[model samples]
Target: MSPLDQLFSNYLPVFLGTGIGAILVISALVGSRLLAPYSEERNKGTTYECGMLPIRRASTNVGMRFYLYAILFIVFDVEAVFIFPWALSYLAVGPQAYWEMVVFVGILAVGLAYAWKKGALRWQ
Candidate 1:
């Protein structure tokens, strides 16, 4: 086969799949827009909370500590995720991988220590 034919053959499925996926997404969006209910009442756009009438502005002051805790949680959660795959493949990948993971964990521990020292881990 010619190079052009070979290239077309290799990428035909990818192009077809992308076109199909796009069509599906566009159809779903159009269907929803056409079939979903629409209302223009003032109450329809108001802030809703637990089926109760909102007494105050919806936006409120959130403490910086909440963000700090969330970031720390995400960091440690991702570390655990990485550790699981490494743990499963440790023996096959040998001592180099083990030492690499040890170094990774050591870095995370140092970060945790630093955060502790800076009072980022304090609850109150």
Candidate 2:
């Protein structure tokens, strides 16, 4: 009947669930260590890198064009994603939402234009 009792009842489930999950995870990990193979090779030169040569110094200026294009692609891809949700709800959301999208897209267009002007797109 009391506010304190109601709040405690609501929060008690979350606290109990978290404590149970933690205990189970710790027990499973300890059990696994006992049952699993343990290896200690201090020199780990063969750490996974897509089966490429384990020793190679990368030249820093190999090609920034890839990174540049990736960034631009993500930027416009995000713009398209935003447009989709807005377009889907446009009829239900009315013209105010549409106007908001126009403002959002205008900002994106300006940014893309600035990048273009700054020669970020030039691969040379």
Candidate 3:
């Protein structure tokens, strides 16, 4: 077989995956358009969350600290999660990986320091 044919054969799974994804998406959209509910009125359109009516207007001011703590939690939480795999791979990959993790942690520490200096952690 030619090089192009060989390449495609080697990557057939990838192309099949993409084609399958496209087919599924198109089928879902078409199926929904044909069979889904078409109500566009007052009761069917109103927003609801946690089985409660959304009372707060989106433009109203809310606490910034709520979001700050959420963001901080996600950042460190993600960092903590990533460190485990890095720690596990340390022996197989040797000290270079450890140093790379040190650098990664250092950068994260710098960002955290900057945030701390700016009082993002404060409950005010």
What TM-score would each prediction reach against the true structure? 0.54, 0.49, 0.49
lDDT of 2 by residue, 11-91 (tens): 998999999999999999999999999887865546666767566655455687888889989998999998887778998
Ranking by lDDT: 1, 3, 2
Deviating ranges (above 4 Å) for candidate 2: 1-61
What is the full ranking by TM-score, best candidate first?
1, 2, 3
Better of 1 and 3 by TM-score: 1
Question: Which lDDT tens digits does candidate 3 get at residues 13-62?
Answer: 89899999999999999999999978768776667676777886767887
Q: Where does candidate 2 have its weakest 10-residue lDDT segment?
A: 53-62
Model 1 clash pairs are none
What total of clashing residue pairs does each candidate reach? 0, 0, 0
Give the Å shift of residue 18 in candidate 3: 32
Model 3, poorest ten-residue lDDT window?
A: 39-48
Overall lDDT per candidate, in order of appearance:
0.93, 0.86, 0.89
What count of clashes does model 3 give? 0
Instruction: Give the per-residue lDDT of model 1 (tens digit) for 21-98.
Output: 999999999999999988789878877688888888857989899999999999999999999999899999899999
Cα distance off (Å), candidate 1, residue 80: 1.7
